[model samples]
Target: MKTEHRIRVLMVAAENGALPAAKVGGMGDVLRDLAPELAKAQVQADQIMPAYGRFHRHPHASQLARLTVPFGGRHEIVTLYQLANPAHPESRLFLLDHPLFSNAGDGVIYHCNDPEPYASDASKFALFCAAVAVALCQRHLSRPEVLHLHDWHAALLTVLRAFDPRYQPLQALRCVYSIHNLAHQGTRPFRNSHSSFGRWFPELAASLTDAQTRRIEDPSYPQCLNPMRAAINLADKVHLVSPSYASEVLQPSDHRHGIWGGEGLEQDLNRRHQQGGLCGILNGLVYPDTPAPPQSFEALLNAMHTTLLGWQGHGTHLRNVDFIAHTRLQLWQQAKRPPPSMLLTTVARLTEQKVAILCHRLDNGDTVLETLLRRFKQRQPQGLYVCLGSGNHTIEAELQRVAAHHDNFLFLNGYQEQLSAQLYRQGQLFMMPSSFEPCGISQLMAMREGQPCLVHAVGGLRDTVVDNQTGYWFEGDSLEQQGLALLARFDELLEAFGSDDWQRVAANAKEQRFGWQSPCRLYRHSLYLE
Candidate 1:
């Protein structure tokens, strides 16, 4: 059978970093994969992102065009450069460059050099959104039938096109706004909008004068631009990154699943859900073509096993228990023992939302790592855990403290991309205990490398992992309970992982498909098919 007819769709995002070439992660990964995949399926797919001032400092990015982008009551000169897809050169990437985004000095992308919000983030993204809007309105760029915007950074495009008469050319265009994470709504008060709307966004602001004239009604802005709010109200459709997360965040306010209430935007989301405009689509993982798969499965397992054997003083527990187990026993007698044979790897930032889940406590007075340690200690004499990432100094300090007391635990407190890749290849197991994950790429990457994951059954993990098949899932309301459940699931994995069983499971895990085929269909149907 042939693929369905495809429509031209343009995607706008803030920082378009995808993997090796790197920008703000997750969302970048999605667009990089999805755009090319759509192109293959016959969609005339193209993307636009800001060319931060420093984008070309290190690597060679292809050039497309250089032009000024008008926004926020002023005109800024933006060079539109091109990045050709290695696989599909027909697919287009227009990078809009500006000094602020480039410098790491004025404003960086949403990744925020720090976990906390930068003081000028609202202004930076506002400028980006406005630039994209004006570019389309002025007809300086060709308008696609559909415009796909990612997260809050690109939300205002839909807002501008919907409300501003000058953007009339884009008024009829279908828009898709995807919310990767609801926690960040890009909210700063109305007083923070363009200082000179009369001079800069003259016609655009005037279009907002009459409440009855605007398609999306919101009196909350000009006081504060909740880009997300406008996107939800104006975009043709909105979606989350995973089905489970979509369901959880859609429940009524008093419901347990709706505890966080989509960062208190549930009312709008509930309406969108009722109108069939809100849902979730699990993200696709594009396995790199550059690094070909290993020749044999045994080669992969042997590599991991060799890494295990090379662990410095980490011991193993066995009934025979004569060698390393003996060493662990000696250490135990001196109260310096650690987990004996278990090895788990984590490659997430040390923030509460991610890696810190290993050690952070919930209101229930229970911490994931603390509870996991209790259960793990009961099963083994000493285990090795390697964590790689950095962000949030408090979490970093806590992880260091845990490493200091546990001889087998090592924390590498910064990002090393190649080292991260190596760890994924050799790690016996991968762990992701995120508090709330929109969509996680690490677990998918680990599985692609034939390593099973241990993730909480939430968000993307729920959609990705098949319990007892590709990997195991543990879910609970509180972090402590989740940790206990994680330990329980791990024990089950340990039981099922015999010499032959493990190979079968690893193969099954690798067999899991993580491409854009399914999700792109959803987008095509929602945004273009009508």
Candidate 2:
């Protein structure tokens, strides 16, 4: 009898957000943690990402191989580099290099010249996914038994595999596509100059002839090529990052109140789910093995001071925690408010999902946060709030305005990993009031650091946190009601901080199993190895 080969996986990630990443976000964190866990389970997990130009300037990636691949009816040589993954020896990361993807500039990964009828982003990602397919199909370096892809960026793998004869070997490879967020469906018209994807991926075009779009699409609408739709139609397995979101996305679009239910791919998702092709896997946390003992307020301040001194040694005397502690002193030379006792931290994107409809235009007026601060001050006047991370420039400006006026609020507009870590370790609470979180990492990070999270029960938050057991949650029917509920929970926690019951909850959260062990075991047994 012939012996079966070892299970190997190739995870194609557009933004694998590992350590050298400018700023680590949720997806990057997940892939970083997960690759190793799968590897530990004896599955070789190799991740491939675009060797973005921003990182190219730095000598981080070492060139591994160079090969020519066909693109835009011609061919170009693409270089492959191996990125270091210190956590997993068996696991590897290959970075695809090409001028269009590399020279696209810093911080921005996806470039779109147009929004309708397909943006130039179409060409960029097509090149990326197509190049990845060709490189791996030819090299067979990893000898992948499974081809795994994340988001719409890598969905083109299915299209490439379906069309190109060079990708015949990939047809025999089991394909798994994971959707971290369903809001972004790469919908573009069939024809475009930059991509000309139909010409390149003719097999997919051939399938569209038999595509029963009217059956799945709205009768009033014409067929527009949706890449996510293509992936769902073509991939062997499809999964959401969280179970609640899996069920939510499977609901009829009309029933999907205010949430993005696969962004017009609901019908397809439902069909796929019924056919047993869809699932939800709660993303696990990358918690440090070392437990953080309960700390004191002085220790928090000392850490800030130490970090500040390190900055001073480098010849700069900027402010951080100290500024919030003495916001009035900067403006008036005297402390207006006795150092606000409570320290609350929120590190997230200032997007609609996070701010929940509170994200607004700055030109319109003061943001919802200004109003929230006004109301919060009326009852709980003494507290220090630190808002970190920036997105939606309007929200960033509004937050700056609030921080400028109030002695209690400090808005740090950037990604500073060290500062975020110190704050999470020291803060009394971490806040994540996302409207629809697939699976939140900040809350898990906060809980692991011994800071209890006060979150709205949704997506991963619902799965990970037990109300009043692991952390506090606020649930309501409407946004306004949810806001009220959040305040109520915050007030309860604030009033009872440093008490025995509060300590018990914090301890319980600390003891919670947020790590990758269980989740990886499931993948090994139920998905990958099986």
Candidate 3:
């Protein structure tokens, strides 16, 4: 009897949830869930990421090999470690380590405050890509039929595979590139800077032809190299996180029309789409066989208060957001009244992509959020709206100012997983008003907990959420229009709250299933084996 062979695949990414403390966003969640699902499909998946100076400290991590990698005009030694993954033993996890991996700080997956945007991170990931290429050349890890690169951080591998003769062996492997967010393209100068591509790969830069340079150069910035563009152009297949987002990127971005398309890469993406090399697949979530018991409204408040107190201890004095949250939590506890008639919750990173519309200035000289608070107070005086997130100091300040003025709104300026899960379970409505979303996990998680969502009709939200059925969605022709539409939709939902229609939507939401089985089947037949 002959044994059947499983197709081998190697995934290079910046974040993986399989390893403790390795996740920062949705990409990590996808990696954690996707690997195990692929394993069940008889696809042997191996995941690799930079150790970020933290994973080697894992008790189960053991050094696999030491390789000398040529990078940045010098040869440097990199340590490769194999990490034990008891949760998904069928899939292997590896991490590469060097001092450069921790240039920003130990255990920091991303350095957002770099002197130049993406300067530190780009340099760090460039070295990581080169080291991975070297590991492949030395046969330190088994070769795979496919090289899967996630986001811009892992995109440099495609560059080295295409340009370097020593890495020519990688040219034979099919390459799949996943674009998680198109807005963040890791573009840096090609030459005349310490962190430029010429500085990192001097010999390769010198030997490149005009056509090769053009293929890798930033479309908008002629002197810069764009890893996102290079991978989109050179990879065997380009994948967006959701089907709606894949189609959205084919059209040019129009801010005036409130459409966030391809940022500036629509031309390249369109070219890929025309050539039949681009695809969009929705991400999957891991669902428990039996759902956990839902917590009471008061229990949710207690959890939020406890989490707030813990965060308060981190600083000598309370920040405005923290102070506001503490005061509101105390007030709610003292009232000893029934939970609010209408409860709303939101959990997201406070970036422009996520919160810009909420902060939009209206014709009345007030922000959209202020308007929403005023309307909610008038419609449901006993309602409470809780928002949990922390990012972008400017946005944080704006939210803090709104919280101070609005008695019904509570702004928690930090994230806690326990508190977030509670928010998902206790709220009557989940709000996600992203200007553009590739694919969102928060809405899925909220729906899974039997809470209907009020989301912007874009990207994954459009795919997973059915308007007025599973949840409610709104759209408009401009930002101000969209903001107004969001307010209108909120009013409509408020009018119908606790009615048969609302309960039906909630029931439909809970019944919605976005499991990994279907998506992994697509991964096997469409992405990997295709």
TM-scores of the models, in the order given: 0.80, 0.84, 0.97
Residue-level lDDT for 321 in candidate 3: 80
lDDT value, residue 86 of candidate 3: 43
RMSD to native, candidate 3: 1.7
For candidate 2, list the clashing residue pairs, or say none.
Answer: none
Worst 10 residues of 3 by lDDT: 83-92
Clash count for each candidate, listed in order shown = 17, 0, 0
Q: lDDT per residue, candidate 3, 1-530, as tens digits?
A: 87546889999999998876688888998988877788877788898999999987888889999989999889999999987554587778899999999987889898877878899999999999999899988899899999999999999999999999999999989999999999888999999998899999999999999999999999889899999999999899999999999998988888876779988899999999999899999999988888789678888888888898898786898777887888888887898978988999999988988998999998989998999999999999999999999888899999999999998999999888888888998889999999999999999999999999999999999999999899999998789999999999999988999999999999999999999887877777788877
- lDDT of model 3 at position 445: 96
Candidate 1 deviation (Cα RMSD): 7.5
Q: Is candidate 2 or candidate 3 better by TM-score?
A: 3
Best by TM-score: 3
TM-score of 3: 0.97
CA shift of 275, model 2, Å = 1.3
